[model samples]
Each structure stands twice: as structure tokens, then as C-alpha cells.
Target: MSVTGKYGGPLPKGPWAERLHEIFDRLLAAFGPQHWWPGETPFEVCVGAILTQNTNWANVSRAIKNLKEAGLLNPEALFSIPRHVLAEIIRPAGYYNVKSERILTFVAFLMQEFSGDLDAAFSLGLWDLRSRLLSLKGIGPETADSILLYAGGYPIFVVDAYTARILERHGLVGDDVSYDSIQSLFMDNLPSDPALFNEFHALLVALGKGHCRKGRPRCETCPLAGIHLNP
Candidate 1:
């Protein structure tokens, strides 16, 4: 897509910025804070980000609850547990064996790089920490950004299928664009604020689930119904 610019930085007042603002405002008006990433701690958020790969939140929640009940929710404890046992505990999240290894990988990275302190891992400036996360075995762009934004409160926007569907439907971004390209639409136009990114992403997920669905979109009732549609 022809979205990326030469400077690749936040733009001045323009259509792009205004459109993003309009979307955020309308979505917020329709739905309040989503209280997303329902985790008790940053470590739990990180675990959720990893466990949520290809699964719904309901299943991920069950898996996490199992971990907590077993007293293996912390990184240090999870790291010491047997791989197969960890896999069994998180079986509810699906892809148990693989997710088990991935969670262990992330915990080990934390233990080694930051001595099991999520704050230290989060304190590594956005790009640095994101790069480290993307290097892990199963962590991809969406997963890494979820860890960064939802867990560490980083200022980077997390792009997912829902965000992509909304932007494409509104003609803000073309269909099947690269993740970074779609992400630039917000990160390059909106002010760099973690709170804004967090709530905006959550709002998009809400819209995607409630109205702008994958199979059949209810555009007429969508919060962003007529904002950016080229009529």
C-alpha cells in the first residue's frame, strides 16, 4: 500500500490525523473504556499475550486461571515447572505443548535479560524491547505489540485483525496492507501516548466484535458508520 511517507513521523493537522481522531472519538462515545487485557499483573498480561495466539480470550482466561490455581502464574515459578506439566496446565488455551514452550521462552528471556523484572524489560525503550520480543520463537508483530502496549504500557499501537478490518472498510487503509503500514496510519498521525493507543485499540476490538464483523459487517449501526465512507 502507498501509505508510508518519507519522514515516517507524526504528521501535522491534515485529513489523516483528523480521520483518526474522528474514529477514536466516535468509538469512545459508543463504548467506554473496554478494561481489556484482563490480567492482575504485567506478568499475567505478558502470559496472556502469548497464550492468546490463535485462541479466544475465554479459553485463554481458563488457561490462566488454571495456572493461578496451581500457583504457577509468576515467571520464576513458571520457568521452573516441567514443560509437559506447563503444557497440561494451559491445555484449555489450545495448542498446549507449543504455547507452553513459548511461555517458557518468554520467561527465560525475562529472567536472563532483566532478572525476571518485567519493569526492566519494559523500561528498554519501545523499539528495543519490541525487537527483542519479535525475536522470540512464537512472538510475532501483533503478539509483541500486545505485550508492549497492553502489558508494559508502551506508546506503540497494536494492530490486529479487527483494526485492519475497520480501516480497510473505511478506505483509510487498503485491504491486506502490511502491519507496519496500517500501524503507521495511527502512530504517524496520532500523538505518541500510551493511553490513547491502548484505548483506541480496545475500542477497535469492540467495534470489530459488535458491528464490523469479519463475515457480515453491520456498517449502518457501526460507530464509524458514515465518517470515512467515500459516498
Candidate 2:
């Protein structure tokens, strides 16, 4: 899987999408769709995506619990809370100061753009919503896709470290691949369905965690090993 430079080379075609689908199907057969972004509300999903940045889900869960306990889980309440208080409450998520400010920034945008209505705020057409989200201060491609696919029911594929690592291991995408390119690869090949996107991303995370790791990739026992015979 060693390549010359990063990204911008030929893409993995042929049975590429089929192989990816096969891996996803096997994982789903084993682990189910995961139905991720577990939250009682869309606002909670969006908040979780923001807080989950650069941290694991366990810490994000703790931070969400903190907000729920403080009754600051809603948009209005979160917006009204003092910055320091919010930061203190989300301290378990790490980088609390910055994440708190980022949350406030999003809440403020929601208030101004959609009158504190998350549904309305997220009601824009898919591309428009993604563009608007990307324009936000702390929202990058992954966060934007998370909010779009999980929270707003868009079909865009969300690329994470796990997806990148899996693709790199299979020589699908290079290390320096641009976010848009990797994202487009999946979106272009797969049918545009939120459920599929959701399950696909989760399966990639599962595979990355279980096999395609950072240093020592478990290629021998990897689920995708047999699928990528030519690679």
C-alpha cells in the first residue's frame, strides 16, 4: 500500500465500490447499522458532533451528560448560559474552552439565521446546508457532514480518521488526499441515502478500529483483505 506522494493519483475503481460495499455488508451482518449519533433531539446530535471533535465518544457522552444535568441541552438554554459555565460543564470533553466557544458560535448563528430553530436552521437544501455549515468557524468537512447526514438527514458521506486510514491501507486514497476528493469518491459511487451513509461511516469506523489500525494494520485477518486481491 506504499505510495509515492499523497492523493491526486488514480482512484480505486474496478470492484472498488463493490468491495467497499462487501466489507460494509459483512460488518453490518455482524454489528448492525449502529444507528449512531444517539440523541433524543436533533440539537443534541449537532451538539454531540461538535463536542466529539478531536475526542472519543466516551468523553463526548460525559460532556453531554453534563449539559443534560445542567439543563443546558436546549438551544436557548445553551445560548443563555454563561460562557465559563458552559466551558466548565463540558470540561470532560477536553479543549472545553474552545469547544464551548464553538458551541456558542453555532447557537448564535442559529438564533440569527433561523430564530433559534434548529430544524429551520437545518432546513436549507443539502448543498446549501453543507456550504453554510462549512462557513461556520469550527465546522470542517467532517463536522459539516456529521451534522448534515446524522442531524439533517442528508446523504453526504462523512470522512473521519477511520475512513481515511482504511482507504489508505487499501491504497484507495493517499495520505494527503483532500477531504472533498475522498468524500466525493464515496458519494459518487454509492446511492444517495442517509441510512447507507450512516451505516457505511460506522462500518468504516468499526473496521478501522478492529483491523486497519495506525501502525500495525491487521491486514492478514482484515475483512477487506480478500476483497482487495489485486491491491
Candidate 3:
């Protein structure tokens, strides 16, 4: 099952799409389906995407809970709340001041451009919506893609640190590759289905958390242990 041998042969010449599908299949077989994007609504998913920047999901969950308790989860309520108040409420998420501003800015954008309707906002074509989202102050590619895939149901692959680590280690991509390039490796290869993209990204995250961790990985028990790197 190794991708390379002691002789250090050349990398597999198979289509990257097929290889990626194989990896996906292996991951799916190992982890089952991951019902990701732990949110009750599209708006909540978008909020979580923002708050999750540079933080863990537990903190994001606590912050979202705070908003829910205050009945401020909707666009109008979030927009009307004072920035300082919002920051205080989400203080547990870390960098609360900046995150509060980013959230408020996103809410304002939604209200002004889409009349506070998430469906309308997401209805734009994929590239168009992604461009609009990336134009916002704090939202970057990962965040934008997360919103597109998980919240808006767009067929776009979301690449993150975990994805980069796995691909680089497996010799599928260089460490210096751009996010778009890495993402295209999945998007251009896999079927353009939001559900597939969602599950694939979740499975990658799960692998990263459990096996392909930072520094020395616990490769022996990794489901991907059979994979060998290119010479």
C-alpha cells in the first residue's frame, strides 16, 4: 500500500483526481461521514466561520452560545448591538474586539447588499459570491470557502493548515503552494458536489487531528499509513 519504496522510485503517474478520490474513499472508510459545520442555521454557520479564525471550535461554540442567549443571533440584532457590547459578549472567543468588528461588518454587508437574506446573498454564482466575501475586511479564502461550502452549499473545496500538511507530507503538493492551487487540486479533480466537498474536508480535518498531527505524526496507526511519499 506504500506510495514509494526503498528504491525511491518516481511518483505515481496516475491522474491526481483519481488519487484524490482514492484518498477520499480511504478516509471515508476509516472515519465514516462527518456531519460537520455545527450550526443550526446558515447565519450561525457564517458566524462560526468568522469566530473560528485563529481559535478552536470550543471557544467559537461558547461565543455563539452567548449570542444565542442574548437573542442576538440574527442579522438585525447583531447589527443593532453596540460593537463594544458584542465584543464583551464574545470575549471567550479571544481577540473579541477584532472578531466583533468582523462579525458586525459581515452583518452590515449582508444587510446592505442582500437585504439581510442569506439565501439571496448565497444565490450569486460561485466565483462572484466568493469574490464579494473575500472583499470583506477579515474574511479570507478559508473563511470565504467555508461559508460557500458549508453555509451556502457551493461546491468549493476549503483548504486549511491541516489540508496543507497532509498533502505536503504525502508529496501531493509543495509546502509553498498557494491556497488556491491546493484547493484546485481537490475542486478540479473531485465531483462538484457540495456534500462531497463538505465530507471530504471534514474527513481531512479528522485525520489531521488524530494522526497527521504537527511535528512528528503518529504514522503507524494512521489510516493513511499505507501511503508512501514520492522520492
Could you say which candidate leads in lDDT? 3
Worst 10 residues of 3 by lDDT: 1-10
Q: What is the C-alpha local distance difference test score of candidate 1?
A: 0.86
Task: Give lDDT tens digits, candidate 1, residues 1-231.
Answer: 111221233545777777777777788878977787799999999999999999899999999999999999888898799999999999999999999999999999999988899998888999999999999999999999999998998889999999888878777677869999989878878877777788889989899999998899998788787675432
For all predicted structures, in order, the TM-scores are 0.92, 0.90, 0.92
**Stretches of candidate 3 exceeding 4 Å from the true structure:** 1-14, 228-231
Q: How much does each candidate deviate from the true structure in C-alpha RMSD?
A: 5.0, 6.5, 6.1
| Clashes (N, CA, C under 3 Å) per candidate | 0, 0, 1
Superposed on all Cα atoms, model 1 deviates from the true structure by an RMSD in Å of 5.0
- For candidate 2, give the lDDT of residue 117: 96
Give every collision pair in model 1.
none
Collision pairs in model 2: none
Residue-level lDDT tens digits of model 2 in 1-231: 111111123334446556555666666765665778788898999999999999988999999999999898888898888889999999999999999998998898888889889889667899998888889899898988998888988878999998887777667778899888988878776666677778779878888888888888887877676666223
Off by over 4 Å in 2: 1-14, 229-231
